[model samples]
Target: MERFTSGAHEFLIPMVFYSLFCLVLTVNVAGAVSIQDDCHERRCNNHEPPVRFPFRLQDQQPPHCGYPHPGFQLSCSENKQTLLKLPRSMKLLVKRIDYDARWINLYDPSRCLWRQLLDLNLSTFPFVDEIEPAASYTLLNCSSQDEALYKGNRVDCLSTSASQIIAFRSDGYAYLDNLLNCSMIGNISAPISPYFFRFRLKWNKPDCGDCEAQGKGCRLKTNSTEDQTECFYIPKHRISVRERLMIAGIVLGSLILAMIFIAVGWRYYSEKKKKEGLLKIEMFLEDYRAFKPSRYSFADVKRITNHFKDKLGQGGYGTVFKGRLSTDILVAVKVLNNFKGNGEEFINEVGSMGRIHHVNVARLVGFCADGYDRALVYEYLPNESLEKFIFAARGKDRSLSWERLHDIALGVAKGIEYLHQGCEQRILHFDIKPHNILLDHNFTPKISDFGLAKLCSKDQSSISMTTARGTMGYIAPEVLSRNFGNVSYKSDVYSFGMLLLEMVGGRKNIDDTVENTSQVYFPEWAYNCLDKGEELGIRIEDEEQTETAKKLTIVGLWCIQWYPVDRPSMKDVVQMLEGDLHVLTMPPNPFASTDPTKMGATIPRKPVNRELPTIPEIE
Candidate 1:
């Protein structure tokens, strides 16, 4: 009895103690999640906003601040850049993170895109490169270029320096020497041009769109493996597979019919909107009507425009006719063409303009989308566009006063500011040149033309754009190449900066007639002037107007800074323009070329003091 008690009691006592310790540990771990606030917002650098639990900077963040261990960890470099370490020895220098959209833009700091591409192991990492082309080429760093083996195009870099990576189509892949050299195939990427030092990165995360709609911040659902995120205030959406299948079928059938009708009606009239104008868009917009008002019929449009007689102007889309809505009200009826490419122009105007209303923004009074006919009715500005004023014959009497131009700039800034923040949805007018700015009888500038507008949530970090938008001179660097930066409202800000510079110099940014090579790009010229305190010798009406020109030039320089991070927001732009001119300082040059010249630059070479003096006419 004594022996049995000694062995059994000792074993049972120790086991019970161990079990109790395990229970307490599990409970404490669960409590750690339940007891704390959902987000601990942290800003890694000035360029990025406050990041939370899912993304934590290494060494800087406490343990349990972000994900516990391996996943979602980032390291800060000496330059204050956040580094994303991927599996299989790949590193990405993070430029910015859109926490709401869960999109991250990265690049190789060394400016060697080829090295990063060669080391990539896509299967090992969760990131997806959507902005880049789906195609990639294999580069063989050889002792010498063999005439026979060199089937692919030899990348011409900055004269002496050439790209090691050779671009080869699948047809040319067979010509490469596989056995003679160490052939390394790059991963998914853009064309084998000069390295631009940028890549777009995206990660798969739980959908928090609904959660944000419920006004709750997203959090990692504690102790979960898959579908680990949840909105703090709202339950996660879950539906059975059968229900999902049924819903998919219904959406598909509806889309198919709508696409067919829109395709058939392509030859009719309505201006612009190429890709987004697929008839299937009505499904999304119908619910959005709560965000809009009444829709006008094609007959009403014809009647309003007096049978399309009073023509105001004509663009790539269609003709704008000035019409009288009533004796007291005048309207601009823009009639679009039939099918151009897609119907993005029609979709852009009605979808975006109808939802927005501001003193600075042109009011979308009504619209006509009758089959094969689309027309947008807007408040008429008797003074026409800011174009006639800013580009007013250099010295003609029609040229606007400097004070009035200042007011127009401020008004446009406020309008863009409202578009970016005041509304329920942030609208990015990819085209923000002077042409899109209409002046009322009182010279109050109203932003018009939603033909290239994009709607995004106010909190979203970035929005994806499939194709480039806007006129040539006003297009931002990032809009054409993702390597410059992610596309956001900042793209519009860049355009605005160019517009202001044009106002100061009284010339188009890309004008070849300018005698000075540095002045060809108006923004760069303006920067040089302000940087050196050289007075912009424009036709000034009054002595005080010089101060106004200085202020606009300084703000324009700041807005047109090469990187999006260096540019101010529309909100900030308004404040700067409204503030004292003496306090404003010059910004870094916007035309400073970071990468080597690409293969096909047509501009003549001149030794300019600044960088990229002439804008490359990239298609």
Candidate 2:
């Protein structure tokens, strides 16, 4: 009897469990779906507002999650901002949404709501402003002198130096007597709120007020063909002992599958990205190997640089380290950073330098493009850059003789000329300053750092440039503004001209530390001094040295003319620098202008040099 009782109890328990599992599987096979399965509230991002009925996030929620009508859709921007596209292609950012109030606050993505209001046509949209009465406002373009009249009401962004825009209520236009100077540009009818640019919009269609009153959620009917909605009781789903076990198994299995997929996908993506980068470098090297620059391995680079022991210098591109191939042969190895603008700077340096061989141009000994590591091996210059010697202190013995300075200047100009015309295609050294000029033991200047260089056809007079390039003070006026002239080889000439002025004055072209505010800009002060025929040096006894200073100043001023056409080419500059001092003529005052303020007493006076007794020659 005891054995029979135990056996029967075990069989009954197994049967009950098996029967329940069969029933649940049959229910699932019958296509029974929960009413509130996918229509639940969802958000694009945690910071963004949750969306439900009458509005839905397009890609995130199903079609039935939102009302089946126009203007009820929302999307997430790449930056995770909630976005709503209004009529006439006006896309605005959804700042906030109040579900109970049935209103949403919207602001323009461009941060210029007035510009959107200019072309706004909201008749096609479902939302409307019910609080503030829509009023017609006349946009007025008035002279900047009348900015005080509009004060806080002025659109600062739309306003320029010559004119300003003011929004005036159209009804009060006839009453205002001081609007004669303001010309009406256009008229827009929008809600006038104290918030100015931002406004609130409310929707009235498919209202869910009754559901809120009953403390229940509302949604459209699942099976009904019509646009019928019903208030639903928010069910608290309670899991029984058996149901809890099933749910636990399903969740654990899903998590395992998800983790496996993620691991495999991440590994595949990493390998593909690495392969693509290495393939790109290999393809480039295949075409560039003919240039005869040796390619080194990563291990070889580390060995040559002595594991990056001796630090040389660092800049925007990367860090340089003093390295050696042998005890007798030395190399300056520049270990490039991973963020090489996607290898743009590295490619520019290698591609431009590989095609040229000159006495004044730095030699590219070898390079390493292994996996993620990159380095450029260059002929190490014992004297480092010309910047170290040129801007030496007042009493320092680093200063060079006038003749030596002339030779360095000529060498740099010749190197620039070679880059422009000596190559197969013209290579424009967008950045040309003393910092880039490397010097050997004999102080022979070699142009280095071709990261900012650009290559174009030799006959292409003006290269198309969407954005400005080069150092701040040395950038050509034409590069900053097309009004001056097109950007060409003449751009480099302007940079060289700035370098020349800095060399001659023994100070920066723009020095704000001087006691005299007027003479802060050295180029203008030097031009004024040369124009007045004043002595540039206070204690220079040699006449030849003074002449040399004057010649360099004149050449620099001529090269920095406001217009590119007015500035001499590098070829002409070379001739002027090498010619006799008497043959050189005074350049037109670059600072001279037709503007009254410049011509008046506000113009900068002569610079006072009390630190140095002599004009320091550039090394």
Top lDDT hit: 2
- Cα lDDT tens digits, model 1, 389-409, are 767777576788888889999
Task: Please give, for residues 1-619, the per-residue lDDT of candidate 2 as tens digits.
Answer: 4564476466557555655665576466334334456767877789988888778888888988787876788888898888886556667788888766788888776777777767464445677776766666778888888778787567776778999988777677643666789888877765534235577888777787778677788778879888787878987656567666666665665566557557655766776799899997996686466446788999999899889999999978789999999989899998878354565556555766776878899988888878779888899999998877777764468777777778889999999999988888888889999899999999999999876777777766767677898888899877887666678888999999999988887767776777766457777777777788887652255989888888888999998877676789889999999999899888777665333223122221223211211111111
lDDT of 1 at 306: 88
CA shift of 96, model 2, Å: 95
Model 2: ten consecutive residues of lowest lDDT:
610-619
Which runs in model 1 stand beyond 4 Å of their true positions? 1-293, 338-352, 515-518, 593-619
Which residue runs of candidate 2 sit more than 4 Å off their true CA positions?
1-291, 338-349, 593-619
Candidate 1 whole-model C-alpha lDDT, 0 to 1: 0.69
TM-score of each: 0.49, 0.49
lDDT scores for all predictions? 0.69, 0.76
